[model samples]
Target: MLKRRTRDFHQLSPVANALFHVIAASLAIIAVFPFLFVLIISFTDENTLARNGYRLIPEKWSVDAYHYIFQTGDSLLRSYGVTLFVTIVGTLISLCIITLYAYAISRKSFKYRGFFSFIAFFTMLFNGGLVPTYIVVTQLLDMKDSIWALIMPMAVNAFYIMIMRTFFSTMVPDAIIESGRIDGAGEFQTFIRLVLPLSLPGIATIALFSTLGYWNDWFNALLYIDNPDLVPLQSMLMRIENSMQFILQNSNNASLSSGILQNMPQDTSRMAMVVLATGPIILAYPFFQRYFVQGLTIGAVKE
Candidate 1:
């Protein structure tokens, strides 16, 4: 009887496992479908895209849209360079400022830590709104139409600083700091040599976050930038989308000209532009993901 019961349980287990696998597979497909569709659409020929919209497999494959974008060569290449430069410079500046501020807050001896924390936390909950901030950026700071507008306004994020401070307080040993002091290391030296090395995971995590923010940002460019030369990849993608929409809506507009408008593949071009703009970040993510996960896990635990 016991053997029969065991056999019955074993038989049921396989059926249950199969059901679970079916559900998990369905969820995975649902999550991945949009990305797959975008990739398919990017390669689809203009005529097929205009006639049938997107398909899992392209009826006809053409690199015409990509060719056109690359034909504009220097424009796309220069935008890419600007994006890379801003992302790198902005991430480094943000990381340095956030680390120093977080370290200051983490020190128990800092007399005004609580007051400073309150001010930082307060800004998270409330802000002067868009108009006032715009006035400050454009009028007061005179950052309008410049790359500084993109990098300066959001250089330091308070929440990230707090997370870093929490990680420092919890993970870094007090005795290690004391030993460094005994060795006659100055405060800045101790922070540079000891604190930073130990805080690699947190720093990398924040750097990735800041870089992603800078890379994906378009609002700053939209509001301030007038020179086409200064546009970042995201802003250029937005312009491409808008231009495609305009061409679609006003297909009759004389400005398009006959042969050029007829040959222009708006739908496929939009998808291709999206792929081009986002391709770098997607390719770069896996390398940084492990550091991001480690930082989040370490920073999450409180002292």
Candidate 2:
């Protein structure tokens, strides 16, 4: 009778259910408001923006900022290409290396798992510092002014490796692995055929994280890329920011022709650039969100 009463209470907890839904709604608003503001501001008119700060709804609307950005279209388009290339290539390479390393460590039979894990973990706690690492990358590796500089240095993160290891350890059953072995499947073959298919959620999570990191990266470009042609989207955005200030400071110059400089909407352009740079990720979120959430939950709960 006590067990039945407890079960009834658990199933019919309206008060608790209401509180959970309220919290969820509040968090959804908190997460969505900033993005809403950004979207509204991106389409807002330059003159209106100059007079007023950001608004939830635009007083006046225009695509002048976007038009200006896409006018010549070479710089923005090239930067986007660079970013896309880096994100896709870097994420794939990082995922492959991280998954292999994580799988190796998750194996109890691997003789050097402990030592390798220690090496990976040690990086998380301590490092040679920025100067030494920069020297090695720029001077030793000669990656400066090259796209490889952006991709290679950040290929593996220790925390990500640990999460992958944790996921493999908990989610992948030992029985499946033993069966693979019984069928004469080698370790590599088993990982390729069996382990990888099961680990898609975790891999997708890591891929999204790595892709965003690569896409939004400016630090690598700031350090390694002096060539304007090699500048990624974020770095190009930084350049545009500085250019806006330059145009505003020299607004009275004779070269400031009627249509070109006078019509340039500096304020709106900045916001539009923000939207342009971030738009891809926002659009991409829906596709990976399910896997991302599942991966994080699986990673958080230990066996």
Candidate 3:
């Protein structure tokens, strides 16, 4: 039956098949064009960009933007390290917490599932305001200026828990759990050994989401962190942009000459920061591509 269905699925006419391929290619190009354009603009000369107002092929190309970003070598590297640590640790912690909470709520046998699920869902509709949240993180929790400030706030996402819960409820059968129990497996053992192995696609999808959240987060750092060493990559790039703006704004008052300011790669450096920040994260997509698609589609389907 599967083989026959596979054979029948490929029975498109030559014109139709060609049209489909063309559509796919066009969509792929549309998605990739923005990144390619940003990369090109990063290498474009600041003066040329200002004069030409963003061209596909600028009159002059320069690496001044990259040079400016990398000028503070030690700080940049430290920021990269901090960002990497946060992304990796935060994603893992988020996955563990989300998976555990979601799986527990997904089980029909769990009596308190509704109570816990409601708590998670309630957070989605509303949150503690910024001032209260800041006070809690800074004063109550005492996480101010620490790396934990970045990791803890984003650690558990209600939306992700919901996704994982749906995936578990839809995809993982109760029979499997009963079988694990029959085999004398404890709840933890069954979850770790049987359930997790079968839930790879769903887990991978959640991991990718968590990774992007951690990698792109700078707001938490702005609110709670002042330590230079703990500042993540996005926060560092933001500071660079802010510094550029301040210098440009006060260039007249400061001893810095107009020529030096004019030569600075303000526009291109912003684009450069975008390219640098997004490049590594983009590489991660291909790894999760298959699982992400499968997870969303399969989990969304109701039995």
Candidate 4:
């Protein structure tokens, strides 16, 4: 009877449940309001925005900001192509390396697991300084002015490998590996055919992290890439933003025509850049939602 009665111990009372719902809904709105406002402001007319300040509903709407961004459609498309290639390739490479390293360390049977784990964990605490890293990439590897400059720099992360290791250690049962071995499967075959299928949540979590890191990485491009053709979407957008700021700062210069400054969609263009940068990544979240939540919760909890 005591065991049966314990089932309701965790249940919320009606009033408490209603209060939680209200609080959650309120917090969700508070979090989402800024992004929605930015999207609205991006469509607002620049003159009206300057005149009235920010408003949920603007006096006038315009697509001139988007038009400015798409002014050179070919260059925009090329940058998009480069960014897509980097994100996809980098994420896949990161996942492969992280999972393999993490799985090896998670296994108790692996003789050198402790040594390799220390190596991975050690990287999290320290790294070669920027100058040395730059020298390695440019002089040693010779990836300067190349697309590899963008992808290779962010191809592995020690923190992500640790997360995956935690997930494997806590969530995967030893019996599964034993069963595969008993069925005459080799180590590589067992990992590929059995383990990977059950590890989707953890893999999805790592993949999303890797994808975001690669997509948003412009610093590497700034460091190693000199060729305009190798610039990713984020780098290109950043360059455009810098050019806009320069023009605005020097608006009073006699060489610059007043008409060009007057017609520039400065405010709206900044918001538009946010929308373009974040839109695809936001769409990607839904696909990973189920696995991502499960992975995070399970990976964090240790027996």
Candidate 5:
């Protein structure tokens, strides 16, 4: 059996390898520490936090934060469902639209490729603004308060389309497309069967991008959705935080009771809600982890 040879330039010497690992580990810790701190603070008792300020290990531990968040189980679960549906459905639709647009612009044979490309670029530079966009979706289209409100507003991202166009133009070979045509496959068939499978790195990149966009979006729900059932997880979480802040702010007023304020889990519960809302999305990253780097690098330096 032959041993696999590594390129000498790419291979790091022992001390260099150790240094590289050290730097990577330090960066990883820098990225992870804030989230870890948030988790620890969520378990820290509100009294401990008030008395001592933030600490890695609090004088006391409690789950009141989590308890406060989950106290409304039905509302939490319903919001979770709404968010999941929007993210999944929106990501799928957005990926399809972005890929098709990118592919169309990538093909040299397409007569109006330059015109379409100009349109995509134009969108990236300018928009109708929020007021006009809101009017179009709500008054003009009459989709206000619908689930479509959450999904359609951000369905197409121009930046993503550009990334995808770069991938298709520089990475996918013209000969392969021509060969597919020679084999009796139409343009749509070639794209669906051949191009898409070959372009998974780029497709996965767009999928991850769209998934993160849809899952993290709360502003769309805030603007267009008035129906409680259509509210997303992040928006619901914001509402809870706002309510707690309002109650805390007014607690000292003559009309309010100090005892009730003292009992409320404001800081810790907000932290806990942050944890709950972000945990699933963070977990979802592993599915896209493999393709992320590959997709970003392909055709990045193409002529």
Candidate 6:
């Protein structure tokens, strides 16, 4: 009777189930509100925003924010292309390096797993200072103004590698690996043909992380890029916004201040920039959501 009662306790009453969904739905709305507000503000008229402050429903609507961004469509297009290329290439390379390193360390038979694992963990604690790293990239490698500079800097993160290793160590079955060896499959072959198919959730999690990192990166471009054509979208937006901020900050002359203020696209354009920069990356989350959840949860509780 006690065992039966224990089993019955696992099931929730109808009121409890309804309460769970209500809480979940409220949390979801809270999560979605910031993005929706930014989007709504982007469509709001500059005058209306200045007059009324922020609102879910604006008194006046305008496409002026988009119009401001689209003023130089060619530059915008070029930046978008550069961002896309960097994100795709960087995420792929990061995943390759991370997964292989993770898989190697996960194997008990590997001779130097401890050494390599130490190296990976050590990175999380410390780093070469920025000035020296900058000199290496700029003076030694001479990658200034090159897209490779952007791609290489953030290619692999140690924390991410550790997560992947944890996933591989805990989730992959030992018997499956032994079976692969029994079938005369080499390390690389087994990894590609067998391991990857089973490790989709973990791979997808890192891929999503890397994708967001690359797509949102601008500091690398700011440091290395001198070529106008190679600027990524985030950097491009930063430049535009920074220029406006500079003007506003230094406008000691009232004549100049009035002239600039009269013609400026206003806060709507800033919100529009946020919307434009973030929209594509946010859309990608849904595709990876299932795998990402599994990967995070599976390794969270270790046996």
Sliding window of 10 residues with minimal summed lDDT for model 5: 294-303
Candidate 4 regions exceeding 4 Å error are: 1-20, 293-303
Off by over 4 Å in 3: 1-6, 290-303
TM-score of candidate 6 against the unseen true structure: 0.89
lDDT of 5 by residue, 13-84 (tens): 999999999999999999989999999999999998999999998999999888888877788899999999
Lowest summed lDDT across 10 adjacent residues in model 6 is found at: 294-303
Cα displacement (angstroms), candidate 1, residue 108, comes to: 1.3
* Candidate 2: residue 34 Cα off by (Å): 1.7
Best by TM-score: 3
User: What's model 1's lDDT at 168?
Assistant: 90
> Could you arrange the candidates by TM-score from highest to lowest?
3, 4, 5, 6, 2, 1
Per-residue error (Å), model 1, residue 75: 1.9
Residue-by-residue lDDT tens digits, candidate 6, 1-303: 999999899989999999999999999999999999999999999988999999999999999889978887799999999999999999999999999999999999999999999999998999998999899999999999898999998988999999989988877888768878999999999898767777889899899999999999999988899999999999999988987787777778665757667667769999999999999999789888877666545432225
- Give the C-alpha miss distance for residue 298 in model 4, angstroms: 12
RMSD of each: 5.8, 3.8, 3.2, 3.1, 3.6, 3.4
Worst 10 residues of 4 by lDDT: 294-303
Error of 5 at 149 (Å): 0.5
Off by over 4 Å in 2: 1-26, 249-262, 290-303
On residues 192-239, what C-alpha lDDT tens digit does candidate 2 reach at each position?
887877787888888888988998999999999998888999998888
Clashing pairs in 4: none
Candidate 3, lDDT over the whole model: 0.91
Predictions in order: lDDT: 0.83, 0.87, 0.91, 0.88, 0.88, 0.89
Candidate 2 clashes: the total is 0
lDDT top scorer: 3
Between candidates 5 and 6, the one scoring higher on lDDT is 6
In candidate 6, position 245 carries an lDDT of 88
Candidate 1 achieves a global lDDT of 0.83
